[model samples]
Every structure is written in C-alpha cells, then in structure tokens.
Target: MPPAKLKVGLVQQAVSDNDKATNWNKSAEQVAKLAAEGCECILLQELHSTLYFCQQEDTDAFDLAEPIPGPATEFFGELAEKHNIVLVTSLFEKRGSGLYHNTAVVFDRSREIAGKYRKMHIPDDPGFYEKFYFTPGDTGFTPIQTSIGKLGVLVCWDQWYPEAARLMAMAGADLLFYPTAIGWDVNDTDEERARQHGAWETIQRAHAVANSLPVIVANRTGFEPSPNPADPGIQFWGQSFITGAQGEILAKADADGETTLSVELDMSRTENVKRIWPYFRDRRIDAYDDLTKRWRD
Candidate 1:
C-alpha cells in the first residue's frame, strides 16, 4: 500500500550553454538538500543536464542525445541511493542510430531503475522544434510503479492533453508529474506572455481536479540565447508549481529564479475529493466514441 502522505520536491533551475557538468553538479546538490529536508521524491526539470536544445532545428543538436542507462542515469542513480529518495528526471533519449525520444526516467530509492515514460506529444512550434528531434513515444499511458506510489509521468507537451491525464488516472496513477521546458518567445507582448503562462498553469491545475490527483510540474528558468544570431532566443518563465487534488496551489517557485519547492501531498485527499465530486462515475464511456475521430465531420 502507498503511504498516507508523500513529501515531494521540485528542482526549478536555469540552464547555461553546453555546461552539462555544472548543471548536473548543481542539480545534484539541490537533490541532496531536498533529501535532507525530508523529501521522499525529487523531480528535476526537463532536460536538466543541458540547455533546451530544441529551440531551433539545427541538425547538430542531435549530439545532445544519449542512451537511457547512459551517463545521466548512472549519475542520478547514485544520488538516489545516497539520498534514499525516489528521483524523477527528463532526458533526451537516443533510442538507436537514427531514433530519439523525449523521455522521463524514474529511479527507486534503492537506485534501481523503476520505469520510464517517453513523451507522447511532440510540439513543433516556432522556437520549439521538437518534432525535428524526437519520435512520438510508443510507451502508452502506463503509470510507473514506485515505492512512494504509481506516478503518472508526462513531458511538457503531454501536459496540455486531457486524454493523457485521463488515461493515467484510469490506470491508477497516484499523482501526475510533468517534467517541463516551456517559456516565452522573448518577442511576445507582456499581455500575451501573461496569457500564455496563465493558460499553461491553469490547464495543468485543471488536470489535477479532473483526475483527482495531485499535480507536480518542474520547469526550467532563465534566458537561453538562440544559437543563430538572427533569432531572439527563449526566455524561460519558471513558475514551477505543485497543485492539490482539489486544484489548489500547494507550492510555487519564482518566475525568473532557480529554487527548490517541497510540499507534502496528502494521498488520501484523492479518495475524499472523488467521493464528493464523482466525475469518473458519471463518465459516458459508451457515448464517447466520437472522441477518437479527428472531427465531428
């Protein structure tokens, strides 16, 4: 059985250019601190080892991809064992010679590899050309079982889709964790930027209420200039946060700074919330076949 309460930690940090060692060391220190603070599970932001290389479609960026159990896994695995805490991290996965994926790996406290979730949704917007790098995940909406509980791990793009969260909830996920890398275009108006950020957070919070599961999001911070001089680069708006099953904000980080957020999640709250607002019980599964279609037409 899962514990009644789980203390989770989020590492919201900035990334510099090509400084993998520094990034890893800094995040490791943060993880150690969170562990000392009694965090049972620690989640790092997306692509924590390096900068968000997907800002442009440069073919050379493929060099950033590495194997799943490669250097990163070994590094974080040792930390998990040393700190005795479940660790969640996102990685640029090199599946094979010409295949890659945006992947999330979960490590049990014993330092063993528990499971992984390849990011299902791959966004290809301007200043965010992920489809050029990652192949859509073959791994379905299966929650990873851990000592703390079953974790519904998703990537940045997947967080926007209600279907992803619903599938995980139906599969018995105890909580939803999104290791994310999203931000502003640097050229957008202040009002547009606020709207984008608000939508990003509001949608995730709605997922928590809809699934009756606590939601945890860890996002990168700071400005990473574009490799191409003509481009305006991305200004990553941090604001990493944790929300309760009732869609209430539990903890939140600053928008432009690096910080660690730790919050105690009451696992039993899911049961109580579901009982009062039983959306699952009222789901019209039989009448939802049209959902699979591209459009009503």
Candidate 2:
C-alpha cells in the first residue's frame, strides 16, 4: 500500500532559449531545495531542459531528442538517489533516428527507473505544433508505479481529455500528474486570455473530481519570443496548481514568476469521496460503444 500522506513538490520555472545546460543546472538546484524542504516527490515542468521548441517546427529541433537512459535521465537519477525523493520529469524521447515521443520518466529514491508514460494526446494548434514533432503514443493509458503509488502521468495535451483520466483511474492511480507547457498568444485580448486561463484550470480540476484523485500540474512560466519576428510570441501563464479529490485547490502559484509549490496529499480521501459520489460504480460501459467510432454517420 502507498503511504497515506505524501508531500509533493512542483518546480514551475521559466525556460531559456537554446540553453539546455543552464536550465538543467538551475532545475537541479531547485530540486535540491525542495528535497531539503521535506518533499517526498518532486515534479518538473514539461520540456524543462530548454525552451518550448514546438512553437514552430524546425528540422534542427530533432537534435534535442535523446535516448531514454541518456544523459538527462542519468542526471535526474543521481538527484533522486542523493535527495531520497521520488522524481517525475518529462522529456523529448528519441526512439530512433526517425522516431520520437513526448515521454514522462518516474524515478524512485533507489536511483532506479520506476516506470514511464508516453503522452497519448498530440496537439497541433497554431503555437503548439506538437504533431509535427511527436508520434502518437502506443504505450496506452497505463499508469506508472512508484514508491508514492500508481501515478497517472500525462503530458500537456492529454490533460484535456476525460477518457485519459478515467482510464488511469480505473488502472488504480493514486494521483494524476500533468507536466505541461501551455500559454497564450501575445496577440490575444486581455479578456480572452483570462478566459483561456480559467478554462485551463477548470478542466483539470474537473478531472480531479471525476477521478476521485488529486491532480498536480507543473507548467512553465514567462515569455518566450517567437523565432520569427513576424509572429507574436507566447506568454506562458504559470499558475501551477494542486487540487484535491473534490476539485478544491490545495495550492496555486503565481502567473508570471518561477516558484516551487509544495502540498500534502491525503491518499485516504479518495475512498471517502468515492463512497458518496460513486460515479465509477454506475458507469454505463455497455452503452458507450459509439465512443470508439470515428463518426455516427
């Protein structure tokens, strides 16, 4: 059984353009600090090693991809062992010369890889051209087992899907972690920006309520200019947060700065919440065959 009470930390930091070495060093320092603060598990934002290169598809960006047990994993593994904290991190995975994936790696305090999850959803929006870089994950919706418990690890785009959360919950995940990179276009109006941020927060909280599990999101913050001067850059709204089983906000960070958020999760609350709101027991699985169909034509 997993521990009843667990303290988790999130590193919501800004990224620098084309500076992977500096980013790794800074993140390691943050991890060390969180470990000192008694955080049992630490989560870093998606693509934390460098800028969000998916803003525009460039052929050279493929150079950023590295093997699973490559340098990046080794660096984080040493940190986990040194601090004796479970660490969750996201990376651009290089499967081979022509294949790649958006993957999350979980490390136990023993300095060994616990498990990994390949992001299932791939978004291809204007400033988030991910489909061009990542191949859709074939790893399915399996949760990663760690010392903390089963972790439903998903990427930015996967957080928006209810099916993903439900599958992870059914598979016995104690908490869901989204290592995300999302933001607004500089051209968007102030009102539109607020609406976007509100919607983002609401959707993830709803996932927590539906799954009867805590939801933790770690997102990058600050402004990253577009490579092409003609296009508006992205202002990554930080607001990293942790929510309870009932969708109550446990802790939230600011919108524009780098910070580490630590929160305690009561693992036993899921049972109490689910007993009163038993959505899982009444699921109409037999009547949802059309969910798998492309269209009902």
Model 2 TM-score on a 0 to 1 scale? 0.98
Model 1 C-alpha lDDT per residue in residues 127-209, reported as the tens digit of each score: 89999999999999999999898999999999999999999999999999999999998899999999999999999999999
- What lDDT score is found at residue 169 in candidate 2? 94
Top lDDT hit = 1
Top candidate when judged by TM-score against the true structure: 1
| lDDT score of residue 273 within candidate 2 | 98
Instruction: Write down the lDDT that model 2 would get.
Output: 0.91
lDDT of 1 at 218: 98
- Candidate 2 lDDT by residue in tens digits, 192-292: 99999999999999999998999999999999998877778899999999999999999999998999999888989999999999999999999999988
Clashing pairs in 1: none
